[model samples]
Target: MNLDDLAEKAEEYRARDAGITHEVRVCVAAACQSGGSLPVLEALKAECDSGGTCKVKGVGCMGLCSAGPMVAIAPKGGAIPDSILYREVKPEDAADVLASVGGAPVERLHTPTDQPFFARQQRIVRENSGLIDPESFTGYVAAGGYAGLIKALSEMTPGDVLREMTTSGLRGRGGGGYPTGLKWSTVAKMPADQKYVICNGDEGDPGAFMDRAVLESDPHRVLEGMCIAAYAIGATKGYVYVRAEYPLAVQRMELAIRKAKRSGFLGSKIAETQFSFEVEIRLGAGAFVCGEETALMASIEGLRGQPRPRPPYPAEAGLWGYPTLINNVETFANIAPIITHGGEWFAGIGTAKSKGTKVFALAGSIKNIGLIEVPMGMSLREIIEEIGGGCPGGKAFKAVQTGGPSGGCIPAAHLDIAVDYDSLKTLGTMMGSGGMIVMDETCDMVDVARYFMEFCMSESCGKCIPCRTGTWQMHELLDRITKSKGTHKDLALLEELCDVVQATSLCGLGQSAPNPVLSTLRYFREEYEAKLTAE
Candidate 1:
């Protein structure tokens, strides 16, 4: 389709929802759904039916999931729409919520949209989330989707597309912040006739839900980004490796693939050009190691998921030994915006090194637990205090753990630290797929270390001695220390083992397994010492 035709399609979709003035939006994403959003949706829909003037729309996450089931009211058509949230809503409150559709909002149920939880966000990847229905292909198209792919295919050369990405300073959001453009260029330049693009959605971190939320909320955005990557790398086929546990995400992505293929946006002769691309879905069997690219490729190829040493990386020789480019769901989700609004625009929004935004799954003891996106330079204090609303029960904040099992903890002392890649690294942490779990004063630092070590131990694929045996030993020592076992020598042995495991590990899973233990030891050594018996 041509530019005018695409624009017309967008307009056609836009008109369908825009004409409805009064609307009730319910958070139908996984979190809210678990918190009883479906019955609430039915109630709201019934109320809307009775009123006839108002409409009930089931949308994705609006964040603030701790207070779900959440409901919002808004006027549909406007240059800028105004929305009011009702948190902890139930089916019984549907009538009262409906009563406020075109009128005054219920005071008791109202949550100000202007709160820092929502206001502080810069939603590049999640822009369409909660605003459009995820299952509705037309709703996505109406929201200015697929325009980026069209622009890339019809107007720009593949080289031009790579240059745009290079200018954007976009880095992989998947634990390692590798430069995105550099990887794409490597794949594009490789001498492989069968280049492939893969979007990694197999997020298995204990507290991380950023990728799952993005996939469930906006599958099209990820697809568009994947398509853009395919075009840039001269790949005619792609795969999205998502976890089987995320049945909703898998279902939505499958539907999105089918819809996009039917619409001529994906698969064979796109926009009637020489380019033809197809995308398949590969479901991971809940193995954390498969989140790594090599292991993920192995699982996709029907092999046991285990990481091999990397020198010939996935870009050099990947799935089926062809040149492949792999980026996570969040990384791909950022592509459409980068293409639509030039790379310079994205580069301008974030810090000098980390461009655009990072999507984090705010979890643990925080009061406003949900998915959030903030600009790279935003401080941890802002995220924890302002957006997360601190710990519940008015408890004193302890530390926030970023990067899951492979990440470290930042004590309250470093709350003012900038949350970008470099700054987090300085704090002995890495932003591993964006999981920020808050801890309160009541939390035990030793236990925390033991907990994460246990997770890493269990999730270890046992492919290497450093990760398998080392993690097991660390967990035992941490468990012993937490249980007030005898000897300061245990502490010495744990520290030495940490160094050995980190230095000798075969893959990222092994290399970074000791981060949580080491970080807690660095800041909360007193806790470990207290747990030890007198020598």
Candidate 2:
């Protein structure tokens, strides 16, 4: 299809939608689905069909994942403002929920939009989240989707797309803070006939759901970004490496890719241009290391998933020895917006070093346990206290874990620190895929470190000695310490192991595995020291 066809489709969908009196959006994302959103959606659909006043549509994550299954209702021609949200909704409550549409409010079920949990989030990556039916091509087009891809395909050349990306100042959102434009430029510059763009969606972090939310909420957004990236880097093929665990995300993305190809946004000759791109989903068998760029490409190639050294990085020779462009879900999600709104507009959002908003999956010990997209420089205190609504009980906040097992923990004293890349690293933490797990005073720091060490130890692919053995040894030491049977030498040995692993590990996984141990040592040495024997 052509540009006018896309616009015409959008307008047609909008026109059809405007005629409906009430539209009900049921959160059918993994979180809400587990909370019985499917049954609730069925109930709403049945009720709406019976009445015809309200039409039910299953949408993506509504962000307040903690209080689900959630549903939002709005009168036609009006968006979220005219909508009313209901939290902790049940299948039986669907009838009552429908009654509240254009009528009186349900006091117990109503979730206000003005709350800091909703108000504070600047949702660029998640702009379509909770608002659109993710599976609907017409719905996405109606919401100004594919315009970026159309713009890239029709108006600008591939070089122009790269220039716009370079101007945006966007960085890799998948742990490493590499420049997005620089990576694309490297792949573009690489002299290869076959380059590939891979979207790393194997989000295996213990508490991180950021990538999954993006994939579930806005699959087309990621697809569009992939299309733009493919066009920019001269790559004709792409793969989305998602974990087998995230069935819903995989399902949605698979559907979206099929729809995208059929709509001509992806696959052969898009917008009547000679440039062609094809995307496929490669399911990762729950390996955390596959989230790494090299490992992910290896997985896509039907090999054992493990990371290799990165000088001849993915840019030069990757994915069957041709140049490859790798980025995660959130990174891709940012591309469409950066293209639509000029690069300078995006550059103006966050701190000087870290540009654009970061989507975080706030989990553990927080009141508002959900997905949120906040400006990069937002303070840890603001996220934990204000947006996340702080620790649930009267207990004082203890620490917040910024990254996953590969990241360190920041104590309560450093809560004022901005949640940017460099700032977090200074405090002994890196933004590891935006999995921010808040901890309260009740959490034992020693046990917390042990818990994460256990995760790294388990998730290690055992391909390298440092990651495999070091993580195991560290877990052993932490296990001894947390069990209250450790001596001073154990702590020294653990510190030594951290240094060895950080210095010598073959991949980012092994290298950063010691983060939890190191950061805890830096911030809460008292906790570790208290557990030690007097000898």
Candidate 3:
């Protein structure tokens, strides 16, 4: 029942079950709930209940929210050709769904292998996502998981680990896109008696669930990633700062941490290595500002989470005034792969500037709406039309608002722009936590800017003058424009405020808060101009 024995048992169980039968897994996540996954689960359950040849399992979100009520059928064992994925399942079609397990083809429900959505996806962070029960730790280890952590601890040294990460060109996925190895190296070089590694899981961006999916589906991956990071950074303590809204993710992570501790994967020397590390969870009370590093560290220390003026950055002085390395959940999830597979392999996948794959919670007007990961250079058009299955209801793709409220909207003219940190920044946008929301013609640009400005205004920490007051003023102007009560002077004033906030803001939340407005103005200034004249 110890960690070591459990890991062994997990491997044994996987081998033993390698030839059992077959199973069809139905997703019962929130997205699927909206898509009526309960009915699909019930149908699968009924089919399995009635002496069906296959077993049925219920799982968490697969990141494919558009095609909900999704199911993945494994051929009992690890049979050939991989398991088939079915989307948009209905209750009445359960019998037909079950029939597709062996030979029959439920043409309507099937997601073709050649489809763009699955064709290019390389699932690493999402490896165990749709297939395994999130609550089951054993299910995770059985799926070639934890082997990475074991490899890192039992084989590689801290310096070696950092080298692999740097060479791999893995950047932070929490919108910053800083090189992962460089961040760790800075923390490692800092002279400190004690150091901390923190996982920034307070994902507040709208229409983004990359972190939540990892926590909900493969909690161990994040944990293992953290452990590897701890080893690399020579840290003994760590915290996973998740949002309170994600009760399910928090529950699963808590369970996972406990399981890891009991199995000796956490707490003390793991896998008989000389190093020791432990992880704890700090739940945020839904404060969007806490996603910032300094604020996150403040919250962990039981203080009111607010951003302070930097210079004593978290890298040098953070989390109880010691050196700390803070990285987002998705960024941490990539650690194991880099450690196990080597950095060159990872660096080879994405674009020249931004290395490694980016997992996007593909929602909005796209067709095959769900969770997807593609290389860095993939075009927005490919993502929207090809992978996202194009806009639903025959609507023309108007624009995509990447980076949530903090990111700019790239209109149809720039749909071909490659997605990466530098590339997006060049287009007056930054890759902000991989939130790609599609917009159709019905979505007014002015209104969209107003909506996101409202969000930024509400989420603003009020600690800085530029963000606290600037964003509020911008919101007021936008509100007037949306209601058709604005004039030409307002537009000029808006530009002035954007300059002030972008230049004087303390942190990223304020610095990037003007992106939505700026990008909208760049692409759709006419919308604001038209609003200047009232009837």
Candidate 2 matches the true fold with a TM-score of 0.97
The residue pairs in collision within model 2 are none
lDDT string for model 1 (197-246, tens) is: 99999999989998988988899999999999999999989999999999
Clashes of each: 0, 0, 11
lDDT tens readout by residue for model 3, 94-158:
88877777786688787765566776677767767777777777777786677777877766788
lDDT of each: 0.89, 0.89, 0.84
Q: What's the residue-level lDDT of 241 in candidate 2? A: 88
Deviation (Å) of 14 in candidate 3: 1.2
- Candidate 1 residues lying further than 4 Å off, grouped into runs, are 50-53, 77-81
lDDT of 3: 0.84
- Off-target runs (Cα >4 Å) in candidate 3 are 1-10, 33-53, 76-81, 90-96
Q: Which of the two candidates, 2 or 3, achieves a greater lDDT against the reference?
A: 2
lDDT of 3 at 258: 95
